[model samples]
Target: MIHVVFEKANVEALRKSFELDPSMDGEIAEVQDDFAVGPLADVDTEEGAAARLQWWKDILAGGHNEGLADDGHVDDQKVVRELKAKLDENPEEIVWIWAAQNKHDVSGYYWLMSQLTEYQGRIYILYLNNLPFINEKGNIFYPTNLFQIQPKEFVKAKKLARVITPSEFEVDPDEWTKLCNEDKGVRQLEGGKKLVSRGYDYYDNELLKFVTKEWQKGNKLLQQYFSKSKEITGDSYLLWRLKYLVEVGKIEMQGDWRNMKDFQVRLPGTNAEAAETTSAEASQS
Candidate 1:
């Protein structure tokens, strides 16, 4: 177990690079050099000097997660805008984004002024993938990765790298597209390929097909569904529609939704009860 706290000075000093948790203000007073907190050679050597030193190093390195000044990261538009300018001037100045194991990626750039403590002169950035996500009936939709990253330039970089949206950096959508339609088999995060030619088993296909079908049915309806699922599809209509279709055998499933095959879909049975509910949802949406 490791414990570390970021100092107020650190947060205030590097507010440009990222946002700080307000909770850390009262807890930590000042920043301690990695060496100062590293190991207390003269203190009780319960863990021994070597172990303690290493522990200090771990604290410094891991302190970012613990709210250390050097570990501050954020997706602030202002900071990103500055970075965008810097990148525009000198893309080569950027070395690497602040990447951590199992942590969100934070992009970094070189600086001579040392405005940001964490990214003062080296890599400085947090991976930003937060787009206004719209989740409707498990099918998540958003304004596109293009709109996710701030300043918009980041989106260009991602496209050039052929990286998928945040959670799916390494996925090769192009390759996945080839697997199924050899055209639309694009991939999702973790190398998850989406296909239409008997692609992605049944459940995945069903979800994709359902979404695609909705899109194809009518652009107006699709817009309504995405802009507000509860409004257009009704609060419970989408779920009940799915149930109705599944129960009636209009859509067959070999297994779970993620792994299904040979399925068809049908609309829900609309009665006074269902109509009233859907009407209410539509009005709200």
Candidate 2:
């Protein structure tokens, strides 16, 4: 059996779980792309894939992850192909796709399941949606991501695995097709397996709400925003949006733009010198 997960953190957690119970041992595969954001138009095609890659490159061009290596989509396709080959090699083998109740995992599930229609019965899903799990502190809480669950709890999570239904195989791919056709920039989980689309600027207003007239370090601002906002996204993406806000004159920026720590941001029309002086005085106090 092969255990498929969506996040990097989940790979390690699942590996730990495997050690806890030898019966659940299997090869782990990670689908390394966040499909919840970005363009999905013709993503299955080479041209469309290239377009999406370019979009990410543009977003990271002048931001924190500017030079980060990113062949994620290509790697994900290879992972899927390898999974199919393994399944063909051994008819008795099965795939267990573990997903939490979040847009990232669900979007990845939709994207992955669409390609595995031929092996419907061989694929199983253990969706941890609205499910209770015991944490390391012996408290009961619901998790939105697989990595958040304790390794010991995963021994029980394995019980939730069920073969992918034929109805889901037919209906879910249609949903993926609709998402690709709509080509929206953001996708959100309404409930269960349902996803809703939103514009590229969906989080723009939320981000703006955290900005103050006083200058704040880029990293500090992002930390505060993440702690306060109900909706959270990758810091790289949020930093990219902050740079966009600066570009459009919605916010003012000071210092270097290359790194989050080197930059400071504030609402437009604020006195930069006064803000800096005030910040220095407050720090001293």
Residue-pair clashes per candidate, as listed? 23, 0
Per-model root-mean-square deviation over C-alphas = 23.4, 4.6
In angstroms, what RMSD does candidate 2 have relative to the true structure?
4.6
Taking all chains together, each candidate's TM-score versus the true structure is 0.19, 0.93
Q: Among these predicted structures, which one has the highest TM-score?
A: 2
lDDT of 1 at 223: 46
What digit string (tens of lDDT, one per residue) describes model 1 on residues 24-50? 122111212221112223212334434
Q: CA shift at 99, candidate 1, in angstroms?
A: 11
Q: What is each predicted model's overall lDDT from 0 to 1?
A: 0.29, 0.90
The C-alpha stretches of model 2 lying farther than 4 A from their native spots are 69-74, 271-285
Candidate 2 per-residue lDDT over residues 130-241, each given as its tens digit? 9999998999999998988888999999999999999999999999999989998999899999999998888899999999998899888988898999887787778778
